[model samples]
Target: MDNKKDFLKQIMNDTGKGIKGYMKAQVTLMIITFIILGIGLTIIGAKHPILISAGIAILDIIPVLGAGIVMIPWAVINFIIGNKDMGADLATLYVILVILRQFIEPKIVGKEIGVRPLYTFIATILGSIILGPIGIILGPLAAVIISSIMKTKKKTDNRR
Candidate 1:
């Protein structure tokens, strides 16, 4: 029926918007990570800090591979080379990066997708518990889709 078609169309549109917004949030996070890593690496006297930070930032966004993929190995290499101070510094920087991402990701994603940070955080945690690693991505996406459906339904009801 036309009503069903319209409803589906509205849901799609809203969900699309939310997905795009989520992508924007991701880019914002990537930029923030790059800046922080660049500064921290430079402070720690790492060679080619900007380049390394950029690479790590890009990797951090990829599924199953994160900043730690490179940073942890690099830190271990430093340790093996007897550069204990550099290894310690790298480890500390990695921890800071992880903490900051955990703190800010939900807030940024929720704001972009029109959900509250608390809801986003809850969804992420639940998703991770239920669905495993992929749930972190899927949980927020599911929230966005559900939110779109609710908003569209509300608008349709209000029009009646």
Candidate 2:
């Protein structure tokens, strides 16, 4: 019984570490996204790319809503005023940001936890769908917790 308890404690500790790793990865992705957008906008001839990027990134950090908060309206205004090129650029940036978060985040996070990426991706998507913007963060974490619990249970059963 003591050995079993110790094993469970170890599993819990590993799970905590894994969760921390994923949160770190998420923040890293956010910062990287901001930097990429800032540089990209500057390259594309936008004024004050740094400020724009900073605002977008801060909005992106907010739950559910993302850079889209700034990008969508700005794009629309540009298009309405006949600056189609700038509007298109803004739209493209938004798409790229989403793609970067969706694709890269799961792979790196799953690798951090030593599990299959598919499940993590599924969790992320489902989380977004179920919980809105915050779901993306929560979903992956919930999956990790569930995964850790199942893994521990399996190990304990095997020993039994």
Candidate 3:
């Protein structure tokens, strides 16, 4: 029916708009995250070149784990090998990176997703479970779209 076609078209238009907005926001957030990460890594490298180099490499792949993955194990290995000074150095670098990431990364990711930290965390977990890694990207997008729709509906209801 013509009415059905019109409704579908309208839904598509709204979804398109939401996706466009979400992408723009996400791109901005990604740039900011990279910049912050780069700066933090640079600072750490300046202070402790070896530990930081390893830490940054791991941080590049893992989002939330940051440098902890590499630095923690490196520290442990150093300790096991009876290199106390090396272990201490790696531990110090790890602590610094963890502190910086805790303060910065969450905010960057939160800004990018345009969702609160808690909601973003929940959405990521649920999204991954439901749609795999793609869900992590799409989940926040779907949340934004749904939020926009709810606001629009509420406005329309107010008029009625």
Candidate 4:
């Protein structure tokens, strides 16, 4: 039916927009992460801070691998090697990164996707709980799709 086709088309278009928004949000987050890590590493007097921060930022984007993956182990090694101050600094930076990401990710992603940050946050948490790491991606995606569907339905209803 023409109505069905129109509905599908609308949904598809909105989904594409949502995907674009999501990608933008991710890139923004990645850049922010990179800058923060770069600054922190430099302050900590780490050699090759830019390169290391870039690597960790890339890893942070990948599921189940994050700045902590490199940072925590490196910190522990520093402690083992009798560099307690460096270890403490790394640990502190890692905690700061974790806390900041938790707060910022949802806000940025939600703003781009045109959803409330709370919704995105809830979706992220629920998705992580139910589906594990990949849920972080899937949850926002599901929210975007559902939001598009509701919008499409409302438009159609208004026309009728």
Candidate 5:
């Protein structure tokens, strides 16, 4: 009974750590995104650069809507008003934002979760492919869970 309790406790602690790792990754990504968007908007001479960056960062937290929700409409509005240069710049910024997310997400997420970044990246991509949009989050999470379980099992086996 005591051994079982210890085992359970260990697993629980590992899970807690995993959760923290995920949180760290999420916060890091969000900060990086906000900084990049803020700097880009400032460089482009957009009015209220800080407000736009803040808005983008907040929007990024929503899995369904994302930055595109605001950017796409903004882009279109600029085009309609015949501000082609601004519209094009906005579109380009959006593209860069997306590309950066794709490249950094797996590495940062995986680093926090105790898995190799490459494996995490592959898992994320595969998850996205198999499960659609939600897969990105689910994939890395699943990997972390599985890896933690395996670590627990190995420790148990060694004790025996």
Candidate 6:
């Protein structure tokens, strides 16, 4: 029927618009996340510049463990080399990084996922548990999708 065709066309248009909006939001959030992460890493590097920078860069790819993975090893190396002062400083920097990761990273990730803080935490844990490192990335994405579905359903119900 002509009406059915028109409805389908309208739906396609709306979907296109939504996809565009979502992509824009994602890019914006990614930029913000990078900025925040850069600032945090910069602060960590202020004291033990070389070690922290190298560690953070190396762990950049890993999901939850991230820079902590690199930083811990770097600290151990420092200790083994008999640089106790540097090792202690690196340890302090690692602690800062961990705190930032636990408290701040979630907030940044939540903004990117467009989900609530609680949901983000739950998704991260559930996702990591089921999927390992990859799960961390997928978890937030899935949460966003689920949230979007719920929101659309609510809108439809309201109209009805």
TM-scores, one per candidate: 0.92, 0.82, 0.52, 0.95, 0.87, 0.68
Write model 6 residue lDDT over 1-160, tens digit each, in one string. 9555654555555444544544554455434434444565566454555454544554555676666676678779988999876677767766765665577556765664467778888887899999998887777667766776666656556766
- Pairs with steric clashes in candidate 5: none
- What is the C-alpha lDDT profile of model 5 across 1-160, one tens digit per residue? 9877877777777777877998899889888889988998998889998888988887886664588998889989999999998899899998999999989987888889888898898877788898888987778777877787788889989989
Better of 1 and 2 by lDDT: 1
Candidate 5, superposed: residue stretches over 4 Å from native: 1-4, 129-131
Candidates' C-alpha lDDT: 0.89, 0.81, 0.60, 0.89, 0.84, 0.63
lDDT of each residue in 1-160, candidate 1, tens digit only = 9888999998888788888988998899999999999999999999999999999999888644578899899999999999999999999999999999989999999999888898899988888899987888888888988888888889889989
**Residue 24 lDDT in model 5?**
91
Who wins the TM-score comparison?
Answer: 4
The residue ranges of model 2 lying beyond 4 angstroms of the native Cα positions read 1-8
**TM-score: which is higher, 5 or 6?**
5
Off by over 4 Å in 1: none
Ranking by TM-score: 4, 1, 5, 2, 6, 3
Clashes of 4: 0
Residue clash pairs of candidate 1: none
* lDDT for position 102 in model 6: 72
Worst 10 residues of 6 by lDDT: 28-37
> How far in Å is the alpha carbon of 66 misplaced in model 5?
1.8
Report clash pairs, candidate 2: 64-133
For model 2, residues 45-81, the per-residue Cα lDDT tens digits are 9999998887787777676577778888988999999
